[model samples]
Target chain A: MPKPLLALGCEGSANKLGLGVVSHDPTTNKTTILSNVRHTFNSPPGTGFLPKDTAKHHRTFFTRIAHEALSTAGISPSDLSCICYTRGPGMGAPLSSVAIAARTLSLLWDKPLVGVNHCVGHIEMGRVITGADNPVVLYVSGGNTQVIAYAEQRYRIFGETLDIAVGNCIDRFARTLGIPNDPFPGYNVEQLAKKGGSVLLDLPYAVKGMDCSFSGILAAADLLAAQMREQDRILSAEGGKLKEGEVRITPEDLCFTLQETVYAMLVEITERAMAHVGSKQVLVVGGVGCNERLQEMMGSMAKDRGGSVYSTDERFCIDNGIMIALAGLLAYETGFRTPLEDSTCTQRFRTDEVHIKWRDD
Target chain B: MTASTGSQDFPCVLTLDVPFPTARLASIALQSLQVDKELSALVRRTFSISSSIEGARGDSDKILKVEYKATTNRMLRVAFNSFMESLNLVVEVMEELDADVLSTPIAA
Candidate 1:
């Protein structure tokens, strides 16, 4: 029996820094995850993570996390085939910090380096975890929101957000509510949304053809939140009694309305992509992919089209090291190597910019 | 320590010399550290390999040298501090993955 190819992956493109090791069997076409460890840097409530602080956090914890990942995987440096790291489409400082670490590791271990695209990592990992083949991908997160599908060895972006991403809109709204950013802001908003059936408060639906806009909706949501606060102030001052012609609004209503509206826009774009590509499987991957409501909505839409939705839990859905390892390993198998001089990170890498050499369809 | 700068107007200058086991390691460090340009316009930085220092004896080159220059002490300090953090991380990875760590029972 031949020994499986092992690769070590490093990811610090955002608030989270993760190190993982995975092994792929050439004969069986199976990927076995040996160890996946992550450390997230969360800012205080009502505040989003700044690039400087987040980069500091990643540098502080990178060596320790890498140690744990290697020890947990119980592999020696000489056993690994290559070192993999995220190369772009993220915060610049954090991405550079991780890239530096990866370069050091590649040189130290005497292994080749493979720079993996961040979005391609999410898409490939989603496909592997959910066993969804040739699915229309809905990639949503803090920095990205795109409807992607593979065509002619490229994950083409059929539609995307014209303004702020859906997750960004939700996260900003969470800040307005002063909700905790740990775990994540989107989660707290989702929990709050569960309690709100009050009336699907009016919000601007910004879907335009296959693309959507979110800033207007976010502005509208912010105004509604201010009104809710004003309503609370008035009720508190008026002996806790409602006025004759005033309408009641709550934070829960705002959250529910935001999720419904933004998710509807996402589903519409995803369905359009599915129809355009003639694919039935819809795979949702990224930080926002962990939202059950979004998954449920996507599932319903897929079922209506005689298909289904595939998603993973927070473990694999959120950015982590295994995805990079998985994607890089695939690229490595196809004789791909990121030369040392060119192992740099950028902030504006597109998904379609990468050649999907590992996939033929 | 202060390193010579080509421009006299940039008075604040600092240099760091990090020794590695081999010249290849020193070259690797230089390559990794030189990729990201300084974030501030007021700061300028450069990296190179320095060999055969006075009292250094090794199988390969003596040091990987990094120099920073800025118009103000505050700018120099901010940029140097960030560079030191990344440098420390690279050194730590080298310490953990190479240099005798791989042969050690526990680290392996």
Candidate 2:
């Protein structure tokens, strides 16, 4: 049998512009990622964040990166059967930039352009890397967190956060703790939680059916932290503060509590989704997926189910182009292409809106 | 082809002329129809007016001319109800209303 076609995927959602090239070999029934390129945007301090500015930045950076990715894979654009890009459910400005770039490339190279859902791309990539064919997908990122399962020409959401995502909760909590907003601050907080000797402060846990409310938890965490700090300041002024080192909840301990509480909520919801779907496997994907504690909890859940918990290494698991490309190729083969007139931008595209096709073999 | 029905269901474009204060009036009318049993599920599609309005000047008789694509009578009725509801809800700026302000629906 002939080998499957090779496709390139482009992603520029949030701050990262990622590119990946992959081949689907039908003879072996496997997909191989050739190479990937990633670039990030750092808004200058005090410069207001604008979606359109990011889009403008993408137009300048994309062509060179595409070439770099192709060359890194030791392949040419001419060898690509199709080019895929994230279509919607992202900042309209950035989505349009990548869309326009993809269309231009497709037109020039005479290749088909497949628009892939960013969320589905993340989930499918997680599935591909972990080799989890039908695991429950808990997708969490800067913008989204939805418990999803693939069925009926769509990846249906079993449950999701009704408000802000779990990661944003952790990130915003870190900021309230005066901790820097970094990719791994949340992870740092996780480690601190490990070291923290439990105070077990009372905090709200909001879970509704399979769906959850992270915003309440986040608000509570922030308020608690703020209130504790205020009390500490008052004690200091009264000369009644801890004798040099005596403290109830240190910064590290606060970080620990935040991570523990957020992760517990996520774990609870994930387990609910798993039990509801009756699926043995669980696939965790997103920036928060990198958290070791989250992984451990999911691993135990998988063990209980007599199944395996699958996750990718930091690179593939994090938002990137490789997942987009891998998922994009499947969509392309399924004849999922958009017309020029119908092309538009969107910010809240749900995962179940698109039909996904990719086999884990 | 054999003649089968008393009246044929012809697909035609009907231009609905809505007399309202502003486009916001039309938008409000549409929003109200979403939960109204008579018109809730009848709205097949909706589009915003793009051209700037300068022709109509009467406060009591502002016109919102909508071109609707409908086939069956039921759908046309829904469109009419939706348009009327939208017309009723339109205001100078959305903040003036007591309704919960929502983030605009993400266009796809």
Candidate 3:
């Protein structure tokens, strides 16, 4: 029996810094996550995380989390096959910080390095955790929103956001309402949206072919929020509440409307991709994949097509090192290793750029 | 015949060795500062973090070294001023919002 392959993955594509260790058994073709650790850089409300700050967060937490992951996995550097780090499609500074850390670990441990694409990491992890084979994937997050499918050894992007990502839309809206950044702004928005009544406020739904745009909707929503705030201020100044019959929009309403409109657009594009690919299985991956509303909507769509929807909870869905480990392990099994000199990270690594040597289908 | 040295021949150079509590902070500062492109062709800048010897020894000690070169003292001072503004913002944000500073572990 061949010894199980172990890989250490470091991820800091955005505000989250994740470190995880995973092992794979070639005989059974099974992958096991030994340890997964993450640290998020949450900024104050109304302020997005700048690349510099996010990169700093990754650098500060990289070593501590890496140590914790290795210790928790009970594996020494000698036991690892490779060190995998997110190479791209993220903030340049954060990606570089993590990449440099990975390079340092490679030099320290005398191990080879594997640079993993952030999107592919999410998809591979989702497939491994949920056992979804060749499913149409909806990869949504703060930085990216895309509907992807596999074909000819490539994760073909069928639909994607033309402007701001879906998660970014939700986050900005949360800031407009001055929501707490603890946990996450999106989670807070999700909570508030639950309290909202079924009154769908009018917002732009921009879907062009298989692509969608969120900036226009974001602007429209911001305007609505501003108007709502002004109305509330005026009403409070008059020492009176909203009139009995006057139409009033609350923050909860704005959140609910935003989720509905944006998620509907996402669901539409995902469904289109599924239809185009003629695949019934839908896998939702990324930070926004943890949203129950999205899963529920995707589930309904897949169910209508006589199929099932697969999604992991926050642990696997939100950016984590385990995903990188899993994907890199697969690539490693296929004799893929990034040489030290070529281990440079990029900010715009596309999913298709990776040669899917591990998968035949 | 006489040899002459011009001001351009002796470029103004500035080096900053900023220390952080941890090598991670220093690396962050280095990476953040490295993003700013050279504003002037006459001015050149380079940044690097000191290797984490203390990290290898299980201690948090790091330093970021930045070097600037400009053809004239005025150009050097002007570029240095802009770099300082960005560097200050990065450090301030790191001090305020870094997970290590907040003592919050991000593992679930």
lDDT of 2 at A331: 74
Please give the lDDT score at residue A223 for candidate 2. 74
Q: Give the alpha carbon lDDT tens digit for every residue of B76-102 in model 3.
A: 788887677556646654644343433
Q: What is the TM-score of chain A in candidate 3?
A: 0.97
Question: A157-245 in candidate 2: lDDT tens per residue?
Answer: 98888898887787666666765434445565776778874677667878888888888887887777777787688777856665564
Off by over 4 Å in 2: A42-53, A183-185, A235-238, A242-247, A357-361, B1-108
Candidate 1 residue B12 C-alpha distance from true site, Å: 3.9
The residue-by-residue lDDT of candidate 3 on A1-361, one tens digit each, is 7988999999999999999999999779888899999999999988889987887788677667877897799777778899898888899778877776676566545688998999999999999999999899999999899999999999998988898899998888888888887798889999999999568899998999999999999999999998898788878785768767767888888888999899999999999998888999999999899999989999999999999999999999999999999899899999998877677767788888888988887
lDDT of 1 by residue, B1-108 (tens): 555554777888898778888787788788788877778889988888877555465546758878888998899889999888888888777777673686777622
For model 2, residues B39-92, the per-residue Cα lDDT tens digits are: 234334334443234554444424444555455656766666545433332322
* Best-to-worst ranking by lDDT: 1, 3, 2
List the candidates ranked by DockQ, beginning with the highest: 1, 3, 2
Whole-model alpha-carbon lDDT for candidate 2? 0.68
Worst 10 residues of 2 chain A by lDDT: A40-49
Q: Give the poorly placed runs of model 3, Cα more than 4 Å off.
A: A239-245, B1-10, B14-108
Scored by lDDT, model 3 comes in at: 0.83
Highest-scoring model, TM-score: 1
| Each candidate: RMSD | 2.2, 14.1, 7.6
Interface RMSD of each: 1.6, 19.6, 9.1
- Choose 1 or 2, whichever is better by DockQ: 1
| TM-score (C-alpha) between model 1 and the true structure | 0.94
Docking class of 2: incorrect
